[model samples]
Target: MAAVAVNSPPGHADPPPEGRKRPPGRRRIIPWAVLALWIAVLAAAVPLAGQLEDAQRDESVSYLPDSADSTRVVRLQEALPGGEATELLIVFSRDGGLTDADRRAAAERVAAIAGAHDPAGGAPRGVPSEDGGTELYPLTLTGLDEEEQAAAVEDVRALAAEGLPEGLTAQVGGPGALQYDQEEVFGSVDATLMLATVAVVAILLILTYRSPVLWLLPLLSVGVATVCAQAVVYALVQAFDLTVTTMAASVMTVLIFGAGTDYALLLVARYREELRRHPHPLDAMLRALRGCGPALLASSGTVAAGLICLLAADDNSASGLGPVGAVGILCSLLVMTTLLPALLVMCGRRVFWPLIPAHGSEPRAGRGWFGRMGASVSRRPVAILAGGVVLLGALSLGALALPGQLKSEDSFRDTPESVQAMERLTDAFPERNAQPILVMARDAAVPEVVAAAESTAGVADAEPARSGGGWTEIAVHATDPPESEGEEAAIEALRDRLAAVPGADAAVGGPTAQQMDLGETSRNDRMLVIPLVLGVVLLILIALLRGALAPAILLAAVVASWGAALGLAGLVFGPVLGLEGLDPSVPLLTFVFGVALGVDYGIFLMHRMREEALGGLPTRQAALTALRTTGGVIASAGLVLAATFTVLMTLPVVTLTEIGFVVAVGVLLDTFLVRTYIVTAASWLLGRRVWWPGPLSRRPEPAETSPAPAAGDGR
Candidate 1:
């Protein structure tokens, strides 16, 4: 049966006078038209979405800064004969000491690997540590793509393990093995993140609605949004040469679901309210859209703008994430605003059956939890605001204890064979670098470059590995272990010496050099991108809220929350989670996401508050009323967003783990503490000044009266 506007104000009832009635034919056609359009879009989107995995580029050069010397060397090497080689080191060792039998067995295994794979040097030569307990055989595999290289590493590993003497073990490592292991983890990350994020969002939605069926609409819509976003990103990668790494893709998934669901919740809440005041579900949805549409647009715009600021970053992954995240948010906004409304109108009241909203029923009575909290803040805004500030300040101190830059070998939560092998090699060969520093120079200057490299302070040996494309590749070994301070210093000295060689045109690169470049570039990216993001977010807030003071307050709160969340992660990651250091990109990513996403809840509350104030409610009461009305939905949105990000912690990669932890913590803090307590309390204290320079600030407060609580007062 069609819903009738029962208990509606005069002239609002269904079957209005003939002249006032809207054209029923057109009203009926629009929803179906929208639904059909979406159906067609998804049909094309789903197939293209599956191709996103192929477009993802996770190679070292893909993530590196193009301006870095290390990146230059890698690019130059790619033009050489056979392209860049996949370097691997096989280590064979016995704890007490290596017996003659162990040596013979290791040599045989190396010979077998050479015969099967045809290593670059024709055959590997064993370098025994003076300790007489460890032997290292370095192998270089050239002329292989990433997939072929990974397969070759696996084959070499299997071959190296065969027929080993009892009490003797062989481990295949080096940059190639590490790359293979890392890629293997990344290969599974997409599926894991998708499944886990879906599960978390589903549970949160069900809990929020307390209805089995109501949650499915938003969840399905968000999924559709994700597929559409992936298709768009895939197309951009093909056409624009965009870089999409597994990291960027994973973050995009979380962002679409989290922010998309937030938009859905706000719209749904308003729709449910309008249901009591409008006869038809379509009319009610139209009213709801008008009420919440601007806020949704502004909030999503803030997030997208903040993310887009990352384009200023020097880091490729960070820069790539800018567009990827923006696309996800924009796609999410388009779907939630268009498709969700259509679905809700079609399902009507039945979707929320357990607590179906009748045409004129009031929401539950009694001052809700948020109302009570708001009242308390209204009574003592100064004290509450101070307490919140103090809490955040104390938490932020933990940042001082945060660990240094993360090393490549320490980037994983679980110790892989490659990490283990690198560790063993470090301990066994403390005086020799297992990995060589690659130097590229003009072929005519090769002799001078080799002499300069060998003469560098910490140099052990330097040899010309190959020559091609008018360049000669020289492999230089240092006297210190890989990634050690001494080794880093040696690489620096080698670069300095090579630069002094006239007409050499040399560049230094290797695993260690790559790590160094990564750290420096991350720091630079942070400095450049943070300000851009903050400025973008501020402008968006000012545009939405129409108030400088309120936007500034919200921006400050989020920045503080970012600091507190980072500090909290620092405290938790080291002592509680056993992590050594954070990923270089984590800090910048967390800040961008935290500030942009954290402001979403603030917009929901403040927008409502602005509406209430504009409607002539007393400023103090408006603050409380907005909180009373929007508190539950905002909380639910926050929980869903935080939970979706928390799913990243389950992955083995430390970078994702740190990002997930920090963002989840920051969202929760923004929800319960910052938005609920601080912003509200600050608004109450600031009163009209919160809207300074806006007409709302200049408007006089309405006269107060002991009127009965309004319908949405939650009392």
Candidate 2:
């Protein structure tokens, strides 16, 4: 009928106007500019890679004496600056009463190690300070902050290795104490993560694309961006003294590749499509860029916005990831849109190797299950949505038992110097330990409390006025101690000891306790963050979708997915891994990852639904089509990404382990639960009202004729 009309146009219809035109996107100038910027950025970033680590190192300091009053503390403290001491602490215990003989023999050895520059023998020399007990050695380096100090873990380990000479032993802790082991272990890990990530990315890209150039080119562009980003981050760190944590590089890798590759995929797919339609390679590149660029920009904007929300965390550690993550995503976005396009254009169809191009229709048949799944979902919206809600609710219930504690000892592992020292100290001085009972008196009666603190049950000994300021000073010592928890129990006992004293109160202050506080704060933050973020993200959805009901429905689905992820984490890690509970920060972090990332996939799916609606496809057909198209890609991408996170389980550190397991699980659940199962179903179930209250819902005028017709057309 259409062909007959065209041939009979003179009689069948009014003569067409002579001069109509192609779409506005036909202009090639913007794409060329994008290409140039990508190349330029790559050129600029590669040279600055060498200095990134130094720039990234932590620079915080410690607050402790030049050395522990005990010889053991002196040895550990002396490791840093000439006169400065490491913030070293040790613990001690004894079952039999402390005989003078025991104290003297321990004292003699400690005396040699204390303040000894001998660096070579007897009492393993360095700076040291004994905390509240002859049993514990507490030391801190002067003029250093958390980020700036190197833990004198080795000195403590050596002293421990030499033997306690009898019943004496100690445990080393504090910042320098904790970091010493962590830094050593962390160094080995960096190498492994880097190699593994690169190898995996290379192997996957090669296998998927079946082309060396396709694999090599994207990496090259990312490499440039990464190195430059490193340099820039380093410079920024130098200026801001920001202490980059162990995970910074890993984060950067994910952001750069995830965002970068996504853009490349969209562009490449479009390019391939255009090549089939248009004979000229240059024209195809231009067309592909023009068509996909706006979509890519919008997608990137959503991702960047989600990440930036991390800045809401008050903790420097969590807040820092925001800008750090954002930078990498930004760079990835730039390289893909510009340099990647230009490079691909230059390479042209040659980029697709192994199977040389003949004609351009898709190289492989464009068939997918997503459309079918979506259509099915469209058929039964209520059942799917209700099931999803129930699933999320069940999973979230498991999170109730999750605990918040620092588990500092576990985070670092076998490598840190201080941890090794603690092992030795525990062996050498059973009576001495590194833990401290941090006493804080907000009132002016600080002196009396310090004096009376010795009466505390855990007090093997107490020392006052070693460091810091104001209406208060600190008194610390190792526990008189049981054979059990050492300072941990001692600190508790000491807290009870102070209770008898009027106008005085105290809390255990040490790495473990501080971490506990951080965990609690993080949980509270999550509580605040999730609702705030959900509210904000919903508003964004409403603007984009332009409807009252649809946005609310999507938000409901995302919540369900997030809840399920949390419950699933509790099930696996809590029961299977036998973790005391998921790490304190795990729930909040999991929530953030779930809610933010979940919403992104939801938005993408809904956008497709909107597109289908506008095209006049009936609701059910549109959802089925959307599933076949967008759902497949979402699933594929989600699988690969979630798998990458799963690899975190291989790492030795607990913090990373928790992050890895929860996030990987969350992503997997999200793809199936929300992206495919829920959203698809909703689109079908909602139908025209899916566009309700928006201009899209009303029927269009007859003059439109749905443009030139769709794929399976021409009746």
Predicted candidate 2 versus true structure: per-residue lDDT over 179-291, tens digit per residue: 66566565566667656656666665675466767878766766666666676666667787655565665566655655465455555655655565555556666665665
How many backbone clashes can be found in candidate 1?
Answer: 0
RMSD of each: 3.2, 8.1
Best by TM-score: 1
lDDT digits (tens) for residues 1-715 of candidate 1: 0111112221132333355655778778878899999999999999889999988988898889878999999998899888988999999999999999999999999999999888887888899988998999999888999889989999999999998988999999999999999898899999989999999898888877888799999999999999999999999998999999999999999999999998888888878877876677888788777767888888899999999999899889999999999999999999998999999988888898797888876666666677778878988999999999999999999988887778888888888899899899888887778889999999999999999898899989999998899998899999898877898999889989999999999999999999889888999998899999889888888888788999999999998899999999889998999888778889999999999999988888888788777766777777877787788778878888999899999988999999999999999999999999999999988888899989899999997654344334211
List the candidate 1 regions with Cα displacement exceeding 4 Å. Answer: 1-19, 23-27, 706-715
Best by lDDT: 1
Question: What's the TM-score of each model vs. the native?
Answer: 0.96, 0.77
